[model samples]
Target: MIRLGLRLTLSGGREAAARLAVIAAAVALGVGLLLSTLAALNAVTTQNNRNAWLNTGAVTAEQEHAPSTADPLWWLLRADNFDGHLIGRIDLAATGPHAPIPPGIPRLPGPGEFYASPALGALLRTVPADQLADRYPGHQVGTIGDSALPGPDSLVIVIGRTPAQLSGDPEARHVTSIMTASPADCSGSNCRVGTNSNGMDLILSVVAAALIFPVLILIATATRLAATRREQRFAAMRLIGATPRQVSAVSAVESSVAAVIGVAFGFGLFYLVRPLLAQVDFTNTPFFLSDLSLNATDVLLIALGVPVGAAVSARLALRRVQISPLGVTRRVTPRPPRAYRVIPLVAGLLELAYFIGRRPADSGGQIRAFLPGIFLVLGGIVFAGPWLTMIGGRLMARRTHRPARLVAGRRLSDDPKAGFRAVSGLVLALCITSAAVGVINALTAEQGVPQGSASLSSTVIGDYRHYDDHGNQLDSAASPPEALLSALRATAGVQGLTVIHADPHPAPSDHLAGGLATCAQLATLPTAFGHCPAGAQTASVGPSFSVVGLDRLLSWPAVWPSAPATAAQLQNLPVDQIVVATDGSKSAIEQARTLLATAYPDQEQPFTIAEDRSQMSQRLSGYQQLADVVIAVSFPVAGCSLAVSVAGGLRDRKRPFSLLRLTGVQLGVLRRVVMLESAVPLLVVAAVAIGTGFLTAQLFLQAQFGYSLRAPGAEYYLIIGGGLVAALAVIGSTLPLLTRITGPEVARNE
Candidate 1:
């Protein structure tokens, strides 16, 4: 029986070969996409693991303060911002001869030497020394190994400093050894930094969830192509004394052979496109090529599972043939789907509503609570699709006057499940796209700065004070030296300068009055800090004020009120803040920042309003890019599924269509019939899916952040429009085939 099946599948003429080819193509697409998603996830994990050790500290405050001579190294990690990019700086000091080395470098460097990642090294060569290189203060000894960096574009510097140089820094740790575990695996104060991949992981999970269903649908649809013809052939064999089990084995063998070929081609397709996939920056940094790979176990599972699943689906499709061969041979229509098929969808919606009412306080909590509802909703769409199609078909049959409408509606009502299956992939893709677009547009909206403050775009504010997490002042450096101040004033883009003096003994209630400046000097400050009070000689400065909160303070600048003060008092106070107004050009702003950083390399770098906005938008942009990529990939996959299913439908109904043509029906009428058969169920279910998606997005946002519905961006409309057009185009492509198949020469009975 197995040998017979193989021969039939391989050499059963052109029609059989076409069926095998279509099935193989659909399965190949599904497997390729599945493996690609899995590889991307693996890359995220690998990157997180590689960069984990840099953020993990092994010493306590006590050990850091009074380190024993036996301690191997002193480690201090600091973050530096250049333009809008973040650079990680690790300052190391060797305290003992037998210091434990980090993963990237061969040995610890002495003073005046540092190791830079390949990306950072290249950056240093391109950017001027005054802007970035001056901060590192060392010659590049070598490049850090890939093992120490998260991705190829990561900027990292490992500098060697003397023990005395690091002793003054309170945050520095006296390290005995480095911990290799990621932040999620580490506990307590030892994990100095939080994981950066949480958002990426969540987005990827959403994408994976959105994609997997369509892939499965495509595979199932592929297996069922030409299913009616196969059942008839099997029914004849059954009537000729073949056992049901033997018939089942033959069906399984045919489907499994196509699937096995598809699996091999899928692996080839993944390898072919991997380099392009590696270039997508899901977290604002492209992944290393080697990171995006499946392990042996994953490979083995996919290789075995796909073919077996295909075989099973093929076997299940022949149940009618097995039970009573005469039923299939006589072209019996199966029982219609029931109203209860819609229950799961309603239940899922109710579950989502229930959770939304509870309103979780944190995002993590909301995600955990919404997962079940999301799964239920997705599953419900699949369950309710056939029922919805049946209802729509019956309504069309009742109302339509056209012959095409009557024929299409009757066919749909008889096998609504098959009609729905042809376009199910598209319905699901639109649903996921709608939800993602809604959330992304809302979250990525810009929080613009106040009006009339555009002049502050090139103004730089430098502060020399450090504060703890609670906003309490830890310590403040003395005013900038006269030479540094002179050099800054002479900088190419510096247009104006103002010095803010610190009040030595501010009253207990006057926490914001850390600095004082003359009214004329304050007037020269950024417009964001409202015009100095009229007729006031001196006024107090706000707490470590910078461009960071300029947007929030626009409406209430008077919170730091001005007061009367003597010129002697202003002169007596120490300087704490330096404001430099530039030429309003990007280069000018960067030049001023470089000078300040050179003066106080250890303190936070000076910042501009533009840079602050850029930094915030940069993070949001990454999410937008990821959403776009996922949507872009999904549309073609769904289109392919729709195309294959439409072609298969034409092939199965060729005899009926040819007979209609012979009976004097026009080609135009037949085209409309085919179009309506696919489009009616598609348009109806698609509308429902889209509404559900937006509703899901709104509920999720409300539970997580108390947010209401916001309009999605232009891209949302484009995706939805493009998806519809693509579906129509795929359907149209099969129309010509309909005309060819229904010719008088091919209209004879099988």
Candidate 2:
């Protein structure tokens, strides 16, 4: 019996090779990604943490006497395992009148670093663009306090000068070093800093919640194994005295072999792809290279557990096969109680209904409110698959003409669950394709009219010394200053002019507002703030602005004069002076005061700042780039999962495919049948997923993000068509196995 069993299994190996080959391939790929992800995580954690001490940099103070709700300094000083720790005191004028000098590591600049993109290094808090111009005309620059945090990204300043620039300042006494921090360091650290394509860290967390996808994946895998593996083969072995456990063991052995090989290959590819990803300079991220890694545990689990899991799953399914191999012919399929299959869907719907009616009261604090949409979509897909299959099968059955069509239609009808399998891949693929298309569209779009202004003409201000609008330098020791403005205005299409100026602040990043200002005419100063009156105070310019009343522009909301800031609020007081921003209102208020103060009463200011139109959709595009990082991993993994499903199915039917030629069916028809077989099932799954994903996007993205998605063109077809094609290709790759499986039947039985 053992010899016969071995012979049977061996003869069939060529046919079953398709299943083993594909599953092996998938396992290898999946394992590879798992390894690379682990490796990358470890590399980042190890290298950047800088001996743990650097990773945990913070301020510690000695509050010997304190209350439970006391100052943060006291807690810092009261370390349970107290050893010498690095603490850099941040003395801001807002926190104290004469802030004491700090006493710790002095933060210094690294070498050969000229300009770190705002995306890289420590996040410098953006000093509002309007505040870059000299406020009191010559107030020496300094920082005071922090305002509300925008989100996960902490704001820091990227000064133009090196750390050496301020080496001698009294303010530098306690000033320590600056290093990049992970989002977890602060409540809002997870914002643009460490997040991916799925919004920010919060949304990424939601996407990571996708860890659950694999549990179901394992189940589906087990189900497919049972479906393809015949009942009588296992039963006959048992009848010949092999124990049921032995059969289970064999199944597990098979699964393990395939998983190990698949994983090894998958990880290799993941690392290979890392270099490509590294080339992309993600916005708002510092540029640096870090080594990648693969965790030992993740590899071990996939290698060891997948086979065991397959065995356990197969045993549960095969126990019934052992009960009665005599049921052979009918064993190709058996009826189940309607409730057995129906109950799962009913249960899902009930759960879905309950969830919708009573969303968890603690659904959110800041960004979590929108995660439900993803769940709603995934659940909807799971529940809707069978229905979609039934509908799609019905439609296919009507149109099918050849024997292949007949076979395809019959297969779909015989097992509705197969439809679910097909839909899963299709839906996932379509979602990814649509999302990719959207991303491509967004990245290529224009930056738009300009930020924070209504001026019509383009303006640049950092290089104020030379070039004119026509790209020619003034070519003189003295630039006409307004000559470029005259040239542009002289052109026919020029409606308005804009201006950008360098930040007069002392820090190197002072140039980074990169001092963009806009106006209708070059002579028109960025107004009130950037310009200094001839007779104004001769203070060296730091960060100061001339106050403008919000009452002046009924349009611009960002800085309206009604907000009421007086001269007293100024760190240094100028009699009859008020602090303001580079914004238009401040410009107007400054102009009025300066004209009254230094007396330039007759200047031309035109159509106001409020007239500019901005495309708010671009912001979503920015956020999407971040979201991609968070959710990008899922797409390829899902594709691999579908690949295995298709490959496995083809392997299971190799013998049957070979046997079909004996019935005189054309090889072409049989091949078509196989393709249809895979396609029919998948279309349903995609349909189900599409419905679910759409609703989920609506509920989550629209409601939470204030982003609206519409079919800008034939997006629906593109989504559906793309999904089906990918599903077909992955499953279709198994076609060559058909010829191999069918070609060798004569030798086996003879």
Candidate 3:
């Protein structure tokens, strides 16, 4: 019977063939996206694990504090938090040759030589080797890959020296140490650290999993839309003595065939796109081809699972449709969706409230608790979609006097589930985009972050690097260079120039090393800097004061200037170490910074301005770009799915529409009905989704940071409104199909 059903479906003439082809193509595209994303995720994870293994052993141990120097295998780590990222400087002799050396480096750094990460190498390349050779003591040879570190732009420098040689100060605190141990010796609880590099990969995989939900929803919607006409044919089978069970089985088989075909095509598409996925560089460096590979088991799982999922969804969609001969022929209005349909939404809201109400043990606990709430809320929105659609339909019907409005309203009321299904993908897209825009606005608003008086300048000049000019000396005791100081005071546009000097000192316990900042040169500073000590003594830079402290002291970090620098000017200024902060008029300070930078005859630009509003905006710009990419990809897919739904509806309603045309209903009214059928529900669902997203963001921000929400600007509304218009355009594209279905010949054919 299944074979007969398959043959009937496959050979059911041009219309069935075309419909099946469309369904298959949509499914294939959806599955392809899922598989490709997963493949890319796996590739990145593999590379990260390999890099971590090379960085530390398979079963490495890490202690919060460095272990005693009696053990030669433990590498002492000193983390210098620069900017927002961590730069790890590890003692290579203590770590030995634990990291796997790729073909690039012939051997590990022997004695004075050091290996830097690719990111670190990029930073080092900007500084002259002669300047670096003194402190580093050897040639800067090669770069390490991500296997050594997780962050994309993290700068890790592995110095070739024993811990004892690196530092003799016993009072100095240690941040963490990577232990070199055999896998056998570091089993289970004995291992101080979990060594498999799956944390990032797992997070990405979960996100990928979440991402597929909408794709599945889209596929199901497309299948259901395309099946509208097929349902009538199945009913005829029932009339010819086919049992309902038989009819369902045949439909399932037909769908399964299409699904299998789609899955096959999906695999091909994934394979074809592997190289493109490999090119994706989330880590700044593109992943190797080997990193992006999917295992045989994964490939098999995708091959089997997607088709099975598609077939099951098809069966479920068919459950509500009556297959009886009489029922198929007669006009039967579907019962209004039950009020219980809102139960999940209410439960999800309750869950969100509870999550928000509870005071978590820590930030981590709050985040963990909050994730489930997010899922629940999103699930609730989906669950409540049909109910919301039905209400919109009932309201529209209640208020409308026009025939077109009456038709659209009644159709929506009779089949709210279908209406919701048609635009489910749009709802998800709206929620994501709305939430992203709202959060981004709150974060990037000019008033979002409190600005200090220090930042209130038309122009500012600064230096970021503190590299030693001579060689391997710590240079912790050196004061600001007299030449640079004299030059800064001598430069044009020199307002009240504040020289914020950084002094590195050993902290007793909290950190491996610390810096002290004195607001000695400035008469006034930002309020956040507090008061400089009574004397010239230095205040230790702690968590509140670290690099973030510079922002408050009227002295920003070593920001490299954006204006072009000449070779002669660059050669004259100190590249790595110099003075920061000279404020004046825009042109004056810039010229002053240029003159100060070029004052030294043989130094690289003495200092570059590192801390400025431009830097903050640049960070926000990255976030904006990421958000735009996500929306750009998702919105089009959603729009296409909507187009499919509208097109399928036209195909399904051919006879009814034709009858309306024959009964003197205006063609324009019928077109309006079609438009409202899709547009009204879409607009309604998008509004609900967007509102939910905004409220969700508000609650989350308030709970996490005690921050009050800010209203998003007009631009955010414009973006969302643009998406709605695109959806409407998709509906408009199907008008020709409506025109064909409502023609006189359509009625005669039916």
Number of clashes in model 1?
Answer: 0
What lDDT score belongs to each candidate, Candidate 1 first?
0.78, 0.41, 0.59
The alpha-carbon RMSD values of the candidates against the true structure, listed in the order shown, are 3.5, 13.3, 8.8
Candidate 2 residue-wise lDDT, 1-750, digit = tens: 334434443455664565556566555555555554455444434333331122122322221222233111100100000011111112221112222222122222122222222221222234232222211122223331122111112222212222343332222322122223433333231222232223334433443445335334533453354244555566666677777667666655555555556556765777677666444423332223353444677667656665566556655556566666555434465442132343443443344333443444432433444344444445545555655565666677788676777778767766655545644644554544444344333333332223333231122111112345475323211112344345434434333333333222324543112122221222243332333333332222322121112223222222211112222222222211112122233333323222222221011111122211112233444445544543445555555666666655665566677677776767788788878776776655555455544444433433433444454348546645654566567667767767765665642552
User: How do the predictions measure up, each by TM-score?
Assistant: 0.91, 0.59, 0.74
Clashes of each: 0, 66, 18
How displaced is residue 677 in candidate 3, in Å?
0.8
Q: Find the candidate with the highest lDDT and give its number.
A: 1
Clash pairs, candidate 1, are: none
Q: Pick the candidate with the highest TM-score.
A: 1
lDDT of 1 by residue, 1-750 (tens): 899999999999998898889898888888888788788877877877786768645544533464344456888887666665678888899987887678899988878999999998998999887777877777999999999998898888899999998878766777776656675454455555534444544655666677667777787888888888898899999999999999999999999999999889989889988998899876568899998899987698779989999899989999999899999989899889999987887776777777756867654566667777787788888888998899889999999889999999999999998899889888888887887787776675434333245556667777777668686777766666778778877888777777777666666675456676767766666665655666677776654455435445334365355756665666555567678877776566777777887787666667775665566565466667777767877777788789888999899888888999999999999999999999999999999889988888787766655667689768688879888988998899899999888987777645
Quality of model 2 by C-alpha lDDT: 0.41
RMSD of 1: 3.5
By TM-score, highest first, what's the ranking?
1, 3, 2
